[model samples]
Every structure is written in C-alpha cells, then in structure tokens.
Target: MTSSHRKGSTEGTNRVRDGGAVHVSPLELDITWGGDGRYWRIDQDRRIAELIQVCWLEVNGSVEMHHLQPNTRYKLEFKIRLKPDAFGWNDSPVYIMAMPGKGTKCIWASADLSKIRKGEQTCSIPSRLEFTTPSSSVADDKMSFGLFEIWKGRWKGGLVIEEVVISKV
Candidate 1:
C-alpha cells in the first residue's frame, strides 16, 4: 500500500510537496520603497528579517498562480506585525489581489495598527486572500498580491512583515 504521505499529493504544484505547503519570506518578495531605499530597512533579528521602517506603507508581491492545484481551495495569508511607531493604517484598509482561475479578485482588509502596545505586547496581523482554483485554468497564470491602499499623498511607516504563506484549504 502507498504511504499516507504519498497519497493525495500535490504533484503539479510548486507551492506544495509531500503534503506540505510553501512559505514565502517577505525579504524574498519585491518590495517597493521610496527613492533612496532609505524609506525601508530589512531588520535582522535571530535570522528573521522583518521589513521595517516602511515609510511607503506598501507591499507589492507576486507569485505564479498556475502552480496551484486546479479546482482546489487555497488561502493567501500575509503575516505581519505593527511596530510602536506605526502610523497611517487606521482609516484605510489594506488591499490584496489574486487570480484563482479565470478572473481577478481584489480584497480589502483592515487592522488596528495604532492600538498595538509596544514592549508590553505584540500583535500579529493576518491579511488573507481566500479563493478557489478554477477548472478552466488561471488567467495569466500569475498572482499579484500585497498590502497597500491609496488614501492620500502622504507617506506612512512602521510595519513588520514576517512572511507570506500559501496554504491549501
């Protein structure tokens, strides 16, 4: 008999293998910053890179969607935390984009970044993109998703991104 680990395997997907999902690190993503690149800094702590000093207050990243299992459900989870000095995320919602099959879907998520108590406690924010793979095939075969909302011309800063996870549901 085949081992359980070998059953129900995601053979054709790059995001999964041996019943395990792929976790994308934030540092690996394409993060846009202000002119001097000084607007953002990759803070290394215990080998963990936290995208901090994000004055741009934005995250634009993409991955190949065609590698997902067709007709299956998945969740695009963004793992992030707010620093003590974080600002400008209160009145607006973070935006995400994805293409499960044939069409593109946009999602908006909100969090209380201002209320996070520094030193006393740490808060984690999860921005999820829940979608179902299309039997017809994913359009463009690529998915672009991130955190950013245009409210004004001013710049905002101080959020930490741990990683981005693509999990089967």
Candidate 2:
C-alpha cells in the first residue's frame, strides 16, 4: 500500500499495507450473478468464482469504502483470470465499471480470454483491473464501492474473478 496522498489532495493518518494503503478483499459468498447458478460457479476453497456461459454478462460485488482517505487518489482493482476452455471473449471487449461515492467510471479490456495463461495455484492466469475512485464530497459521505461486469447483448462468459482490491495510488 503506497501512500495515496496526492500532492494537493487531503491527508490523514490511515495506515495500509504495501507502498500505499492497499486493501485486498476476497469476494463475498453471495455474489450477484446473472442466470442464477447456471452460468457461474464458486470455488469455496480458492475463494473465487468462474463465469461459465450466458446470453448476457453481468457480475457485481461491493465493499464499504469508508476506509478510503478523502481526496486521495485510489484505484479499485479486480483480480480475474481466463480459463483455458473459456470462450466468447474474442469478438468484443468486456466492459468493467467501478462506482465510488456518487461517481462512476468505465474501462474496456480485451475479449480474447484464450490468450491468458492458466494460474498454477488456481489453474487460471491472473489479470488485474485498476480504476480511480470518485472524488469525495460532504453529501456523498456514504459510498458503496464495487466492480461490475457488464456487456451488451452477446454471448459472454469464461471469466474467473478472484478478488477485488482498493489501494492508494
């Protein structure tokens, strides 16, 4: 956790791991998935979830962001992987979005899940997502921050989400 205090941003005494304050949180047990349990599976031992296949794509999980320092530059990252037998990522890129406080931001990633190698521990290569947190304000003191998998009408699947991380950049 590197110190996230921007040069001109507000500062406070909130300790974090790594260089800045970094929070690595595993996904919750009850993750919101599309098509109920048909399209996804949870590996309780590894604490990760895999998206098998579905007509549409939508996966979401949230965590409290109160521990985030005000006015600090933070990146919300999602740890993911692509299974060897995965499909449907070559046609179009998947959309990843994060909502911090009252603001939201979106980013795009390669749809080619086949290119990613498998991880030794989990049998899937690990991928990361980094997005900035919304600037804080008095009114939006209560912020619910999380990552979501959203794509347009298409066949989307084959994504393994291990965890979500919030760290100062």
Backbone clashes per model, in order? 0, 10
- Alpha carbon lDDT of each predicted model: 0.54, 0.51
lDDT of 1 by residue, 1-169 (tens): 4221111112322345436455665555555552223555654343123433443455655556655667777777766666666666655555655555336566545554555554324334544567776666535665566666555544566666666666787
TM-score to native of every candidate shown: 0.67, 0.62
State the displacement of the C-alpha of residue 136, model 2, in Å, after optimal TM-score superposition. 4.8
Q: Give a tens-digit lDDT track for model 2, residues 1-169.
A: 5321111112322225676554433334234443256767666577566776765555444444566666666655556776666676655555444555554544433334445564523322223444555555555343344433345456666677766566766
CA RMSD of all predictions: 10.4, 10.0
Q: For residue 119, what is the lDDT in candidate 2?
A: 50
